[model samples]
Target chain A: MERPTLDQIWAWLDQIPDPEIPVISLVDLGVIRDALWKGDTLHLKVTPTYSGCPATAVINLDIQQHLRANGIDKLVLERQLSPAWTTDWISEKGRRNLQKFGIAPPPKDGEHGSYGALLGRVVECPRCGSKTTERISQFGSTPCKASYRCTECLEPFDYFKCI
Target chain B: MADKALFEFLTRIGDTTLVLGHRVSEWCGHAPALEEDIALANTALDLIGHTRMWLSRAGEVEGKGRTEDDLAFLREAHEFRNYLLVERPNEDFAVTITRQFLFDAWHRLMLISLQESSDQRVSEIAEKASKEVAYHVERSTDLVVRLGDGTEESHRRMQHAVDILWPYTGELFTDDETDRELSDRGIIPLPSSLEGEWKTHVDGVLSAATLVRPEREYAHKGGKAGVHTEHLGFLLAEMQVTHRAHPGATW
Candidate 1:
């Protein structure tokens, strides 16, 4: 029997959509922390997108079913609680994917300088890449996001709050 | 006696969280800012989660048919065992922040001790809650210093809140027979031991805020003994109404 590769595990995980945000896969969300082959069994470590998030059970179930369908039967799912999840964990590709999917990605830290001086910040529109944008609400779709409206495109989008 | 005692201890813990969570939840729409509001609400949610866990465990240990909801919502004013510190109304943002600072300081220490509890379930819950409490303490301490030293009016209000709440702080360190048993068996740490650490952390923050710990001769007690202030009944009335009115109803 040959050892399974990371690519194989990644491909298997691609089938798992975020339970809360169905449009994105766990891999795209950067929540599939680690994958390893131990003996004939595969071990996958995942972190919840948010603390006390209710979607963890669904995510776990999805991962197990997806891996099983991909012919990896022996599986163990582990949850890492510490170090906490941050918006920075979302990858560049994930950001692009999120934008294309009509959900705005998290803003880069210090991009707006200090949150203390809030008005001068230039938030780029996720849709049209326009630099003119204004905050709609400090809170967005979830506790981890803020609502913003693009001045140029006039489309409202969610900006994942900096953890 | 043993079963009743266990139920009482568990209820004390649950009621403390429930009442404090209720008070904290009021900050939801009225916090100083959106971020602070979210933070306070999240903390309230965490406390409510802790209350559910402990109350459910209490129900199991009691061998009573009562579920967590029954214990939470069906209980009368005198049935609650929450400390007076958490039962106090949210006077102002300063009062809320000061109350939180004091409670979080004690809770952080208590949770740290509970993390090593011999009871595996207790230890597990404490381990998780400790992290959250640590953050709560940090946030509270930061706000205390900022507001205390921020402006003349802010400083006066912060100091006044601290003075008013200091009397309630002593009761948290007063342990009863249940606490004694749990501490002796390593199921929980001694409340007295946690007091020293709590005091050190609290004093450090107070000093930075240029606030002095008030010297009070009378410290309130008896919450753990099923005695609470006039506030508890009203709070419980609001919290328990829905569940008590519609028994065992779940959506």
Candidate 2:
């Protein structure tokens, strides 16, 4: 029996959906930073979107369980803190998935250049594509999101907040 | 002695973040709005997560067996090294935002300078924390401007909160013997050095918000020396009660 390749493990991880936002996989979310095999043990580097995200534990467990099911017994999951995770790390596919799932993705130019830039973000409404959206709150249903309301559609939605 | 100073300095960072984190946690479901509710909770978690990192480093520097939990829950109020600003009660929504804004402003500058510390671990933690603090500063600054300039009632309340919290802000820049010692070794930046930039940032935001800077002569002090406000005891009691009641238990 041949050992599973790194690609095979990543493929399996691609199937693991985020617990909160089920439409996106962990890979798409950019939480799974790196993965490789060393000797008989598989090593993975994971970065949490928010340092205190409660979902991280669940996500870690899910990753472990998924990889474990693939017959890899020895696993090392390391939490990398430096070069912290950001909303910009969210993949293009992830942004599309977030939009399709009715949550607005962050701006393509998510650079928090200045205070004006942060407050001046014009996130299009996921449902109506309206530019006349107002932020209801800097926080949202989850730590990683912000609550915004579309003036045109009169709809409220979550925005994947820029870190 | 350098190791001891490093340990002390790290605890100061850890304790202040931990206490403020706990204070913010008290606002979990009680924030004025659902979005603020989530934001405040997220901020609390971020601060607490930072507490774990700094305290764990402190423990390592101290060469002691005490874990982060041991330092956090087990310490008495007098043993705690958090700023009086952080331990003060969250009087209201305005006051909470005011406290956060003031602290975040100084914290951002402090972390930015610490990123250049000769101590690699300290520098790394500072680098990571600087990113989070940037967002925190932005969040508080935006809220401060909104509330301070929003309406007659909001402006009045925000002004009151800023005045009430002003006395505590002075302690953030006052360095002590340990800080001075650390500065000599390039282990930590001088606290006073960051004050100029901190004041500029605060002034900019307050000007934007149409709020006045308080000129009260009384600046609360001694949190660095383990002297805290009367409120810390109660805050610690509530924070530690769960851990104390059920020692060695895990979820």
Provide the overall lDDT of each model, using Cα atoms, as 2-decimal numbers: 0.76, 0.87
Candidate 2, residues B1-251, lDDT tens digits: the string is 43888898999999999999999999988988777888898889889878988999898888868889899988899999999999989988999999999999998888878988999889878876766777788889999999999999999999999999999988988888999999999989999999888899899999999999987657889999998778999999998998899997556
Q: In DockQ, how does model 1 score against the reference complex?
A: 0.10
CAPRI rating of model 1: incorrect
Q: List the residue pairs that clash in candidate 2.
A: none
Query: What CAPRI-style quality would you assign to candidate 2?
Result: medium
What TM-score, computed on C-alpha atoms, does each candidate reach? 0.71, 0.94
lDDT of 1 at B29: 85
Residue-by-residue lDDT tens digits, candidate 1, B1-251: 33665577678877888889899998888887776787778678667767877788788878867788778888788778888999999999999999998998887777777767777667766665654555566568888998998899999999999999999989988888888876777776767778877888888899999887897747899888888899888888787778777877874
Query: Candidate 2: misplaced stretches above 4 Å?
Result: A110-116
DockQ in order: 0.10, 0.50
User: Per-residue error at B104 for model 2, in Å?
Assistant: 1.3
Candidate 2 lDDT score relative to the true structure: 0.87
Please state the error at residue B207 of candidate 2 in Å: 2.7
